[model samples]
Structure formats: structure tokens, C-alpha cells
Target chain A: MRLIITTMAIIVAIWLIPFVLSDESGLKFGWPYSVFFTLATLFGGFLFYLLRMPPMGPFTSSRRAIGSVVLVFLVSIGIITLLANVSPQFAFEGAATAGATAEERGKAVFNDPKVGCFLCHTVQGAGGTRGPDLTHIATVAANRKPGMSAQDYLKESLENPGAYVVPSFDNIMPPVAKALSPEAFSDLMTYLKALK
Target chain B: MPPDVPLINDRLVLWVVSELHLLFAAFVLGSPIFIVISEILGVRTRDARFERLARETMRIVAISYSLTALFGAAMTFVLVARYQTLSNFIFQRFYPIFGLYATFIVVETILMYAYLYSWDALERRKSLHISIGVALNVVGTLVMFLMNGVGSFMLTPPSSPDRARLWELVNNATWTGLNLHRFIANIAFGGFMVALFAAFMYLTSRKEEDSAFYDWMGYIGNFIGVAALIALPVAGYIYTKEIFAYNATISTLLMADKLAWFFVIQGTMVGLLFLGAGYYMWLSIQRIKGGPRFRTYFRGVFWVALIGLIIWLVPQNFLPSLTTKPAGPIGEVAIPEKAIFLGLMPAKGLAVSAIILVTAFLYLLYRQAIATGTMTWGRIDTKAQLTLTFLPAMAVYTMTFMGAVRESARGEWHIFQFMADKSAESYLTPLGYAATVSGLITVIFFLLVSGIFWLGFKVGH
Candidate 1:
């Protein structure tokens, strides 16, 4: 009973001290202090828990050691879970609010799941890398075939991705002509043109 | 790339959790192979010690098998929650295989339980028990091969008009090499764990007879480990060669980009592994009475490993723009230009092969010394005994480091040519930071493994 109370008190104290210390005018406060405090508390709790547990030597420190390990393990994993749960919002906001210009709308469309452009294509090196990087796709399209303009090349690619498979790449691209509206497709071309 | 969701550092989570999963999985897969071998040895030779050893080993295997399942479940959850992009891609294409993988897991668990529990019950029916062990190993190996197929397909995916084709996805260029490499590595890992168990028993045993038995057991376990260790690098070479053939650009980034230094660190760790194993073998020579007579040959073995260490660690080249300077005629000279050639793949490959061969040969000598009755048993130095314990730790460390290298090779892509890693955490960590993180994870792994061994011991008691 004493151990549980003491551990809880220590954990509560650990949680409170950082906020209290940061409130003081004299000290420069940042996330580092909280991170440090959290880590120290975890370790302090782990050590105390292990110290209090019955000994199982050669093996030593009993099952509590595994508890400590799991505590650390879960905390690291929890942080990842938190981050993964949060990031998609930022990515969505950044894309959705890209603006009303042709190039901006094209980017929004490119990133849009409905259009599914970024599912296989890379744009300015930020999207899926399954398809060819479109960082300079505009230039490549111009000289890709004799007598073909860049606009026509881009049009062909959007409608028929299998027409020309890049060397070392599999022709796994599904045709996306029906997935995008004609205006969105034109905007996507503008975005590709500005990529260079 | 983003939905209206909170962000997480998926890469770190995946790396750490996947490594934990791999460690347990390796032990689970590796343990069965040797358990079957030990069972056969016992049945054939009618030795009680081997039978007890085999039974005791199964205890560890059973516990590890449970942990592997637990971690596998956790890893699946992590994939679903955190690595949705890659997870979705895999599941979308290989849904049937995922079902098959789960089925294998269930069947494997049943077989493993039966194998573990039936040892004493079917003692008189030795062949029947042995067959159960073989069935268990087959299921376990199938699990490993199936999992490796998924991982390797990501590294060298096959392109097709139909993206969801099971056969094409699973049979990618790198799959064969990965299966072979992982198969050998699993044996090496299992051997080390058995040796570790024996070492612990040797150290803790009160009776001289028990100690002697464990000492011999440790020797046999370590010998199996080293033999499999010898084949591991060759299998690794095949895997890397396939990756290079799949795409030169991806290969260049893995070998020479920001990740290059991690390979250097991997080489250093491998050198330490060779040296540690060789040194342990050299020390084990003390158990043999006229083991001293082979002292000259032991020294040769030591020198071969030391030289191999030096050659393997030589950097292939300086940073791209940094010019190499000629050595001075006097003191404090730079490493000669000619010396850098030794660091290249072919040269380092030869050096490592020579080291393994020499160490293996020295093992033969140790066996020969024991056979002629020139070697005394149960006479290892305390420190030398500690090195035997250290051998397994080194093996685990080498596996973790090399595993890190293999994943880092994927570099900014979840599936090399098929999918991109566009998560916020897709950036590659610097080599030093990554190595430190890996080292920390290795320590955690050792602690966890030690805990498992302890639990196994307690259960047996």
C-alpha cells in the first residue's frame, strides 16, 4: 500500500514540478524540460520498483524488470501512435488550402485520393515513388517521343500510363482518365509544367 | 498525403517494434531446428543428457514462441494504426497470403505445444515424438519463408499490369536470396541462444558433473553457431547482389549515399563478432590437457581474425569530394592509397572468408584435442567462461546492426519501386544517431532475452 502511494505521489510530483518550474520567471522554459522530467520520472520509478521487488538472481530483479522494460517500450510506441494519429490532418490542411490558382488546384487534385495521382507518382519528390518522379516530368515529356508536345505527352500519360513504361519500372499504372474531371486534368498539367 | 488526423513518427515505431518482433521470431524459428536435431541425437545415441538438454531447450522454445506471437500481434496492430500506407498496400495485394500467414501461426502454435508437451508422454514412442518436432519445424520455417517473401518483395517488387497478383508480388527478384539468407541466419541465432542457455547452466551448476555436462553442451551449441555464422555472409552477399541487379540507383543509395557509414559500422561489429567467437574458441582450448600444444595454431587463428578485422574496416573511399593524399616517407603518414583497395567489396569479402575458414579450422583442432584425451574437461578460466556468455550477446548485436542496415537500404521508400515513404518521419537519421539507437535497442533485447531465459529456468525448476 505504501509503495503504491509513494509511486503515485512521485509520479504526480514529477508531472507537476515541470509546470511549476516553467512558471518561474527566472528560468528559460521549453519542451526539453518536460521531456527531461518525464524521462527522469520514468527511470526513477523503474529503479524504485525494481529495488523494492523480490530478488531473482543470476536473473535478478524479478518480473519488475520486465515491467520497467515494457513501460519504456509502451511509451515509445505510444508516442509513435500519437504522431501517426495526428499528422494526416496537417497534410490534409496543407493540401486542401493550397489555393485557387491553376497550379495550386492541380496540386490539390494530384494529392486528392479520388484522382489517385500521388498513389503512384512523385511530385517535387514528395509523393509516392512507385511511378516516375514528376519533378521534371514536363521536360522529359517534351523530348520523350519525336513530334509529341509536352501537353500531348502529359495527356497520354494520364489516360494511358501503360503506353511507355520507364526502364526498370513495371507497367503497373492504372489508367486515371475517368477518375479526374477535364478541368482538374488541365490544372494537373499546369502543376506539372511548373514543376521544372 | 495527410488526412485530418494526428501525426506520429511511424518510422521509429516501426523500426523499434519490428526489431523486437524479429528478435523473438528469429529465436522461435531457430529453436525448433536444433530442438529436432537434439531430439534425434538423443533417440539415436540413447543418451539421457542429450534428451534432457533437448527437453530443456523446448521449454525456452515454447516461451519464445509465445512471445513471438505476442509481438507479431503487436506488430500487426502497429502496422494497422501507424503504418497504414505500407500496410494497406501489402494487404490490398496480398490479402490471401496474410490469411495464410495467420493460419500458419495458428497451426504452428498447435504443433509447437504438442511437440513440447509430448516429449515425456511419447518417450517410448520416440519416432512419433521426433515426427511431431519435424512437423513443428516445417511450419515454423514456412512462417519465416512466407514473412521474408513479403519483406523482400518490398525491396525488389515485380512490376505488372495487375498489381494484385499474388504469385508475382511474392516471387520478386529478392525473395529467393532473402529466404536463403534468413534461413541460415535463423540457425545461427538459434545456436547462439542454445549456447547462451548452456553457458548460464554451466556457470550456475553446483555439481561438477552438471557443470561438465553443460560445458560440453555449450561447446556443441557454439560450434553449430559458428558453422552457420560462416554461411550467413555468403547468403547476405547473394541478397545484396540481387538488390543491386534490381536497380542501380537504389543500390547506389544503399551502398554510397547517407547510409554508407552504417555499413562501415556493420563491418566493425562483424569483425568484433569474429574476434569474440575466435577468442572464445581459443580460451575453450584450456579444457584440453595438451591444448597448449596447439598454442601455435591458435595464435595463427587469432592473427587471421585480427587481420580480417583490419581489412574489413577499411573504408571503400573517402567522402566524394575529399581527395586522398600520398603517405609521407616519415612518420604520421596517411593510410596508403593501396590500402583503401583492401576496403573494397572483393577484398573485404576475401578477408572475411579467410577469417571464418581459419576460425572453423581452429574449432576442428579443438575437437581433435578433445578426442585424443589430451584435453581436460571442466577446466575453463572464469574470464574465458564469461567470453562464452559474451558470444551470444555479440551474435544478437550483429543481427540487430545488420538488420538496421538492411532496412536503411530501403531509403525513403516503403517499397523500393512500388511505394513511397511520404510520412513526416521518412528522413534518414545520421549514422551515429542510428547506431546509438540500435545499440540501446540491443541492450533492451538482451534484457528481454535474459528475462525469457530466467522464466524458462523457473518453469523447469
Candidate 2:
């Protein structure tokens, strides 16, 4: 009983903390934020649960240990796949989303060498071929058939690299999808979403 | 094309290759199973024949050990030379696991050598040598696990689109399950191959002594085969399920082919073998006379098995594949999902149910064999033993036939077909892997059976 309650309290606490910390946005933060925080926290807790047990013992714990080990091992792989999906510079979003107009924000980040993708990808038949040409990336990948919403594709490209690969190219892209500052990911997503 | 070994005796070449791998897989696959059987037989009879059979089987396995190693090398050569594209894909996509595969084979080879040569000396130190051999063969099975993972990995590379890296690709998701399936499958395959080899030899013997000797060998071989064969379908079911999960499309395509028909045919063979096996168990009761009490038991077991076989033979909707949820970005479109219910082959379900029924009734019917131990050829029955020796030889031939058929089929050489599209013999990979796996399995099965039977014998006394 105590074990179950303590676990629930930890869950409730994870949901409550993000709101308190983010009063600055004062955006109506609610359950969606709670879901992400809760899921992330639970994922972390599961890893902890696995770590405490020696493998090949109690069946449940052992199975979890092995499964967790595989999943933990998958983390880097997941990132590599993310890298395969998108431009590498999506790894960062500027600290300022405070007062800039949306289009100004796109221009600020668009060619900013620090996080701009032009360093690796060519656009408009110019820039670099070190990465895939992205001038039509929004058309080819984001708006690929079967309805990958432009927003989802843009976000995935930044986060998961292996999600889509142009034919003839092996998945060599680096994952910057998760690296996008959440604010930046959302902002960039909003920008890329409009491309289609 | 490098012309066929210029009018070389095709049969001779086939015989050589077939015999060599069968000889090797005999020792490699057979020894552990033989050891178990010899131990049980020895315990039951308190006779030197049982013990002598074990020792002799081990001794021959010892000789076959070198042969098996040599043939294994030939198989590797066969793969690289004959099936390079599929071979390259195997090496590249499955590099990490295949590396472990090489390690296991080296370990198995070394341990088997030690197992064979040291046996005479180890006879005085029986338990330890047997245990050591056990440990070595356990490692042998582990090698099978690594190899199975590599093979199964090709069939089902972990569908984790979310994961990357060579290790992740090799281990993938289905690796463990496939490994489990292969481990068990080999044991069954190994055991049955050995038994059939012995049985064939038993049937062909002319001399009374040879017939009697081969009969004992056959009994041991069949028991091993039946044990392995029975366990195999269960593991195979699980493997099919994993195949289903990894890619329904591939699974669906696979089920549509004649190869899927072969699976059914194999299941029928298994049913017959099961019934035949139960009948044989009945026959073993009257070792003093050629047994006659098993007739009714035979009929009962056969009828039950026939029902299972018939049920198994019933055709189903294979082409109009089951509907499945479309997996990626695609909406409302069906992605190939190997229908989970496909695992419940009505025939298989009936077969297992039949086995249970057979076991119950046959156990009641064959009380004579159960009550009195007559499951062995007498010490004087040298004919049976020698006759049993050659069945493995024929089995190798039969497998070579099936292998040819598998290779010649349509779309069987998907990987090689991709590369060798222009070549005349592009349809070689399926044939090659089948041949390699089958031929290796046969020889190893025999060598192991013979060696273990030899070990169980008390030669000097």
C-alpha cells in the first residue's frame, strides 16, 4: 500500500512542478504539459526500477532489467535516427522567444550560423551539399504522401533523423530533434508548418 | 560460368559433400542426445551393451569431429563462392552477431576435438568426461543460438525503426526469441536426423548381425529424433509469430508460396512420424521375439494422427490476406500484419491435442512395453547396429534433393536475385542456405549418435 501511494504522490508532484516553474509564460498550462512531464518521469522511474535489480532473478524484475537495458541502449540509436531525419542545427533554439515577431524570429534563427541549417544543408540551389538539399525538403519530406502534416515532419526532421531518407542516401543524418529548445522546436515547427 | 567440375561425377561430388556434412553434424548434433539416451538405457538395463553403445558412439563422433570441422570449412567456402551477394548482406548487416558466431564455432571445434580424443582416457573418469562433453556441446548449442540469431536476423531484423547502430541492428528485437526457436529447432533437427540415419541403416542391412546392431542404433536414433521433432513445432510456432510481428508483409508473402505448402507437408510428416513413433514404442515391448502386441496400439495412434494430419491438410485463405492496421503515416490503408491467429494452425492445435490423446491412450495400450523393458536390441544383435549406420547417409541424400527444389523456386533468391538478376543461376541463395543447413545437420546428427553409442559400450569387457 505504501509503495503504491508513494509512487502516486511522485506522479502527482511531477505534474505540479512544471506549472509552478513556468508562471512566466502564464500560458494556460494544464494536462498536456502534465502528460509529458508525467510520462518522462515514469520513463525515468522505470529505468530506476530496472537498475535496482540484478538480472536473471525474479522474473518480472529480470525481464524489466533486460528490457530496460535494451531500451537504454536504444536511446543513442533513437537520437541517431533523429539525426537521420533532420538538419543538425535544430539542436539549439535561442534563449529569446520573449518579444520577437514570428517572422522576425524565423529570420533570426533562419540564417543565424549558430543554429541555422544553411551551414549543412543547401537551400534554393545554394549553401552546402554537406547535408541534403532542403529547398524542397518541405515539399518532398514534410508533405510526403500519406499525410505527414507539415508541422509533424518539420518537428521530426529536427528531432529524429532516421524517420525519412531520400533514396540513394543512407541514414547518416544527426538527430537534433530533441536538442531543439522546446520553445525553439515549437517556434521552428510553427515556421516550417507554414511552408506547405 | 566456371563450368561444372568438368563431367565430374555429380553423384560423387554430391555424395562427398552430403556425407561430409552429415558426418560432421552427426557428431556435433548427436553426441549430447546420445549421451542422454545411453545414460537412461544403461540405468534401465544394467548391461554393458548400453554402456558400450554410448562409448562407441562417442568414439566414432571423435573421428567425425575432424570430418565435421573440415566440412564446415567447405560449407563456408560454398557460401562465399556460390552465394556471394546474400553472403555479403549476411556479413554486412549482421556483422556484429556473425562475429560472435565465428567465436562460438571456434570454441565448439576445440571442445569437440578435446571431447573426442580424450574419451578413451576419460572412460575411466566417466562422469567428468561426460560432463565436459556436455558443457562443450552446450556451447555447441550456444553456437547454434548465435548462428540462429544471424540467420533469423536476416529474416527479421529488429523492426525497431526507432533504434540504430550495428549492435541494435544485430540484437534487434526478435534476436532472443529467434535464438530460442533455433536452439530448440536444431536439437530436434539434430536428434531426428541422427535417428533417421540409424533407421535407414537398420532397414538396409542384409546380415543378421548387422540388422540387429543397426536396430538398436535405429531405436536410439528414432527416440532422439522423435523427442527433438516433437519439441520443434512448438518452437517453430513461436518463431513464426515473431516472423509475423517483424513484418506481416513478408510473412504474408511467405505463407502464399509453395514453401508454405512445404511447411504443411512437413507438419504432415511430423504427424505420421509421431504416430509411427508411438507404434514403435509399442513394438519395443517384446524384445525376445519380433513384437506383435503393438498392432492395436499402432492402429489407434495412426487413426488419431490421421485425424490431426487431415485437419492440418485442410487449406485456408492464404492469398486474400488478413486485414491489418496500417503502421506508418499511412491512414486507413492495411499494412501487412501476419494475423496472430495464424499461429493457431487448426491442424497444429488438433495435432497437439492428438498427441495428448495419443499419449494417454497409447500409454494405456503399450503397458507391456512400459511394464517390461524390451526397447533395445540384444547384445548379440550386431546386424541392427551396422544397418542403422547408413540411414544417416540416405537422409543426407534426401536433404540434398529438397535443397535443390528450394533453390530452384521462384523469388526464393530475393537477395541474390537482386544482384544476380542477369546471371543464369540467380536462384541459388535459398538452395544454398537450405543445402548448407540441411547437409550440415545430417552429418552432425549421425556422427554424434555413433559416437555416443560407442561411448555407451564397454569395449574391453
Candidate 3:
């Protein structure tokens, strides 16, 4: 009877987590999930404790040991299914909205998840160190090769990244030109060139 | 594809062969240090059981040494024939040390054989025999250190490769950390392998005396494993910190990007190891006269460990793949904004530390029980013996999974930023694919290990 009452209280607590934690805007925090997960884990642990108590613990008999294994396996599967179905999806905010100007549109393209330029190349101070920082790419591009124009160098870089290996960096950049539409590519170039 | 290896996938073959070589190599290198310690203890205490353990463990190591060489040779051949460019690059840089490595191997081989053969002959000259054993371990360790110099250089090469001195290449950013990590891990791996052998012998032994001896042996083996395991996470942390300090991108790749899920699985496996070890200790108490008195304290320990396991298993983000979009409702909803904090390093680090602490606490409790009460070694329940058997399986999987994570951290490069893998099979395998390959490798390894165990038994008879 005590187990039943305690379990009911726990369920009530879990059910009330969102309501208790959320604001007027319904902007839920991590508190609800944390509390719910902790409550569920504690409740499961309690059940385990009860099952392992004297008189019929898993270690007491061969039958009980095998039964415990099965029970644990089934519980694991159930938990996995529940987590898969109920856990919140990782929210990746959509790409920046298309801007009025070519440079703005190009900035949007660079920030696009599909383009993934921001994943490696730093614009100002934001990005991965795996590749060379491109904060001064507009100025550096013309000087990278003796005769190539800035636009040609940047275009060549997007199309064939391995052509000019940056010093101290591996030639690891993917072909962004293949992934981009022609217009998007032009806008991205414009945005990059305007960086200076 | 290399024309010389048309029938097989060269990379997969090299991966399996090299992993097999490492498995045997770990045992060969690790078993000796403990075996020598066991020998020293036997000499000091005049305990014949310790002497027999040292002799028996040496016999197994002797057998595995040949297997290690065989696999190593096969791996070398595959590398030279199929991955010619990589072979050339590594050889060009580290040719001088290769001779030193080979010389160490030869000396270690001679010492191992002499130590094994001179046991009865040096019964009167026991000090001489022990000296040889110590020398054997030193040479074996030197070989591993040399190999580590080559291996760690691949992942974290000298910053200025063209201008690097020989010492700079040998002592790369991650070299010392990798050496420390592997040194401790080898000890733990070696201990677990001993436990595995003891458990097998205990199960198969018909004589009561043999069962008692094997049971005690299993206990000592597990003791070594647990003691070394306690220090492993700290060593691993140092190694990871070095990787981060050297290259934040590679660290991010491991902790937050493509390889993040691999760590989640690794956490589960490591958590199981701790829990399994604790359970074995709990069951171990049943064999002591005053053991049941301590049973009540287990509940709290168990609960703390469970919480740690849960925390360690939590993912920072639930996204299965960073590159691919999910096909279900999971793709639609965002992780609770604040709950994300619970899955990060602070929580996971605390969780692992807690798990290790609880394991240490349980070991202490077991020790207390043993100190206070009389022990009946072979009288433990079958469940306890089964738990002992389960630990080695978890240890093997953890080792393999970790190896995959470390190797894959290089991603498309053969040597971090220095050499791009322009081969047909350069792309990183997805987590699912890698897991399948790892599982297959693990199964094959266990099968080979079973044969090695069988050979030990055969030699004993």
C-alpha cells in the first residue's frame, strides 16, 4: 500500500513538472525534463531495490538470477523505446532569412546548415579552427596567388578546395560550389568579397 | 584499390589484424609485470600458489607472444603492400627507432624464454631468476614506448613537421599522455585477462583443491584490475586534455560532433564495468563470515552507482547524426533548452567520478569484510563466478570502442593535418557501421582468445 501511494505521488510530481516550471509564455526550461528524468530513474531504482530485498533476491537462486536478467533486459528495451519516442528533438534553428541585398543573402547562405561554411571557417571570430580563418579573405584572396584576381581565387577555392593548400591547414574543405545554386554561389562570393 | 590485395578490402583487413595484434600485445606486455610481482611475492612468502600463478601466467604469455608477432608481421605486410604511402611516410620519419624497437623485442623474447625455463634451475638462485623477469618487463615496456612514439605522432604530430628534430617527433604533444594512459591500461587489461583465465580454470576444475586455488587466483587478478581501473579515468582525462590543448578541433570532433555518440556507448560500457565489479565484490562478501552484516550498506552504494550510470548515459543532444536529418518526431522538437545543461561535461564528468568513487568504496567494504572474517574461496555462488566472467567481456568492448574513437578522430586525414588519405576508403564510417565492425572484431577476438585459453589448458595437462 505504501509503495502504491508513493508511486502515485511520483507520477503526480512528473505530471506537474511542466506546469510548475513553465512561464506565462509556455517557455519551458530544462527543469521539467531534469525533474521528470530524475523522478523516473528514482522510481525505477526503488523497484530494483524492492526486487533485491531478502526472501527472493536474484542472488538467492538460479531461477531468480535468470528472471532478473530477463526483467532487466525488457526494462532496458522499454526505456529505450520510451526515450526514442518521447525525448525532445534537438532544435536546430533554420538558416538566416533571405536578405534584400546580395551581400546579405550571401551571409545567409554562409550561415546555412547545408552550406556549412561556418562549421570550419571563422568569419570574424566565430567558427572552427580546423580551417584557415576567413575574416580577411577578401584582402588575402588577391594576394594568395601572384596573378589570380580575388574573385577567381575565391571561386576556385569554393570549387576546388585542394588547389591551393593553406599553410598550416590541411586541404579538408568540401566543394561548396557543387552544393550551392549558381545565384547563391554568386551572392556568397559577393558577401565574402565585401568582408574587407 | 591496391592491386596486390584485390580479393580483400585492405583497410578492413589491416584494421582487424592490427586490433588482433594489439589485443595479444597488451596481454604479452601486461601479464609479465604482474607475473614478476607474483614471483617476488612467492619468493618472499614461500607461497607455492603464487609461484604456480607466475609460472602459469608466463606460459600463457609465452604462447601469446608468438601470436602477437604473427599478427604484427601480417599487419606490417598489409601496410607496406596496400597502404604504401602511409607506410613510406611513417618509415621515412621513424626508421632509426624501428631497429631499436626490433632489438628490444628480441631481447624481451630471450629474457621471457630464459625466465620461463630457468624457474626450477634457479630455485636456489631465485634472485637471478627474478632479475631476469624484471629485465624482461623493462625491455617490453621500452618496445611499447617506442611504438607509442610512432602511434601518438600520427594523431598529434609536431607542429612544425618539416623542421622537427628527431626528439621532437618522438615526444609529440600527445606522446607522454598516450604512454601514461596505455601503460596503466595494459596493466588493467593484463589483470583482467588473468582473471578470465582463472575464471575459466575454476569452472573447469574437477578437484576441490584446484577450484580453491583458481578462485583465489581470480580474486587477486580482479584486485589488480580494479586497482588499475580506478586510475584509468584520470589518465584518460590527461590524454584528452592534451589532445584538446594541441588541437581544439579534434577534441570537439570527439566530444561534440561525429564521434560523440561513440562516447555515449563507451560511457555505458564503462558504467557496466564499474557496476559489474561492484556486484562481484558484493557477491564476494557472501563468502566471508561477517559479510552479511555489511549487506545493508550496499543499498546506498547501489543507488549512487545507478544515478551515476544514468548521468553518464545522458547525451548532450539527442541528435543521432549531425550530418543527417532525423525522419521522425525527434527531428521536430528541440531538447528542453535548460535540460541540455545536464548532459554536458560537468554532469558527465561528475557522473564518471562518482562511479569510480563508488567502486572504490565498494572495494574498501569488501576488504573490510575480508579483514574481519574468514574467507571460503571456492564457496562463492555461481552467480558471483558468472559476474567475474562478465567483467572481461565489458573490458574488451570498452578497449575496442575506445580504440575506434581514437583512430576515427583523425577523420579524413591519415596523420591529422599532415597527410590526407587519398585512398578509396578515406571517409569516416558512420557510428552504426563502425559499431558493427567493432562488434565483429570483438567476437573474432574472443574466439581467438578462447583458443589461447584452450592452449594454456592443453599445455598444463
TM-scores of the candidates are 0.69, 0.52, 0.77
Off by over 4 Å in 1: A1-196, B1-8, B161-164, B318-336, B374-376, B458-461
Supply the DockQ value of model 3.
0.09
* Candidate that scores best on TM-score: 3
lDDT of 3 by residue, B1-461 (tens): 22433444776788888888888898899889999999999989999999989988898899888999999999999999998988998887898889898899899999999999999999999999999999999999999999999989989999876568878999999998999999999998888878877877776666779878888888888898899999999999999999999887688767766677777667766776787777777777877998888877776787788788877776655554443334443312225555566677888889889989988988999999999999997766655556666677767767776887888788667787778777766655555555556655666766677677777684467
- A128-175: candidate 3 lDDT, tens digit per residue: 578888889999998999999999999999999999989899888988
TM-score, structure 2 vs. true: 0.52
lDDT digits (tens) for residues B1-461 of candidate 1: 32433333566667777887898899889878887888798878988777877888888888777777777788889889988877887887888888898898899989989988887799789899999889988988888888888888877788761354788888888889999998898898888778877766666665678767777777777877888888888998898889888875456556644455566556655665666676666667665777767868877676667667656655543331011121322111212343445647788888888888887788788788777746444556543445456666667666776677777666566787457676666544555445555656666776777787777674477
What DockQ, on C-alphas, does every prediction get?
0.03, 0.01, 0.09
Q: What's the CA error at residue B113 for candidate 2, in Å? A: 2.6
The deviation in Å at residue B250 for candidate 2 is 2.2
Per-structure clash totals for the candidates? 16, 85, 1
Q: How do the residues A1-196 of candidate 2 rate in per-residue lDDT, one tens digit apiece?
A: 4434655787888566655654344332344335434544453344234223232211134234333332322332233223222211112122234478664566445443335354456655434455776666656664574777666766676778688776766686667555456665566555554443
Error of 2 at B261 (Å): 2.3
lDDT of 2: 0.49
Each candidate's interface RMSD (Å, one decimal) is 16.7, 25.5, 9.2
